[model samples]
Target: MQLQKLLSLIRQAVDRYNMIAEGDKIAVGVSGGKDSLTLLYALKKLSQFYPKHFTVCAICVDLGYDNTDFTGIDEFCRNLDVPLTLISTQIGKIVMEERKESNPCSLCAKLRKGALVDEAVRLGCTRIAYAHHKDDFVETMLMSMIFQGKFYAFPPVTLFEDKNLRVIRPLMLVEESQVKGFVKRQEFPVLKSPCPIDGTTKRAYAKELVAQLQREHPGTKERLFHAITEGKIEDWALPGV
Candidate 1:
């Protein structure tokens, strides 16, 4: 079932980004969302059949929510034999108390990402895997072009300045709908975000725009993904030949 899709994604990421090696310890950042949870489950399933000598551990950053309980995540990881590390941080408090701003996603994301990177390095992980799939990349591309006037999006793989950790997106080839379908089929446990501004955010607007475009133009998503993978940026530098 999903094993095939999971394997295909892993293989595509490996071929595209050279993500895995003979022996690598990869740390997956899980936020208990559909994307991160699906990624962790897929990676755990793929680990059994993958020939690479690598391992995966799930890391969750609890952003200081009093009512947020991680029991579901803990049970899921335990059943899958995957170790889960939950780090408690005062991100929510900081965002709500200190930041006198309407939008909190930017600040909260930056702090959480910094914490994740530091934790990955401290855990001796060579690679940090995220669950940014095709839809996320597409939304980012659209956002950059429309707002920032730049034709840039998140890359599949990037190396940090320290040269000790490599950031990789294994689900870059997977679609958001596919991941949701997989989750529904598997009946995976999902925890709703406890953030104060979860759905009413700018990213949600970008998501809605893309969804509308996708509805109007069938196969638009696939075409955009192909453009990303097949287009040649270097050709822009050359003169008309």
Candidate 2:
């Protein structure tokens, strides 16, 4: 997507959820992938004109994978003038090597997100921003259905009462294709996933299933997104968010 359209979609989500308030400090969880880098870049630009005057810091928790270098990501953050803190961890080793869990995604995700929350709190941030987009939202809902037999998707905004940190997804309105185009058009120094099972997960299955359904039912994705936005699921509602 063009820069203007990208920012407009991000702003739409931000405004809809009351995500940013004046004097809020938000730490964006940047995994260095296309989605995360796009989020970091958008927030960096949005900071200049966003009325609330929020500050952002980028944090990425490395999953202890070999041959994973964040040099380009560091430079990219530097160019955007967003401070980045790369925390190295043994999450990959613990889950894949030590635990040898068949379902590593659940454990690894919790660990990485916990680490990000800790770092955000350490940096005195009141909020955390995730790079989940429209596709991710629908894919996650489908995953829940196929795996857990539930109808649910993550909301645009969430709160962590224990950490006193609010989680916001400003890119909720942007599609995955748009995100990819934005990164390509802007030449973002994106980082690919270093995880061994990156594309061979239940989530990947959900992605493929959604694509297939979209081919059969042309407006499948849009209808799913509408259901999410229309509060078909109890948790998808904007109420008390």
For all candidates in order, the CA lDDT equals: 0.81, 0.90
Model 1 spans > 4 angstroms off? 231-241
lDDT per residue (tens digit) for residues 42-125 in model 1? 778777777777888999999998899899999999998889889899999999887756768778888998898899888888
Query: What's the lDDT for residue 96 in model 2?
Result: 95
Top candidate when judged by lDDT against the true structure: 2
Clashes of each: 0, 0
Clashes in model 2: which pairs? none
TM-score of 1: 0.91
- The pairs that clash in candidate 1 are none
lDDT of 2 by residue, 75-193 (tens): 99899999999999999999999999989999999999999999999999988999999999999988888889988898877878898888899988999999988888999888889
Candidate number of the best TM-score: 2
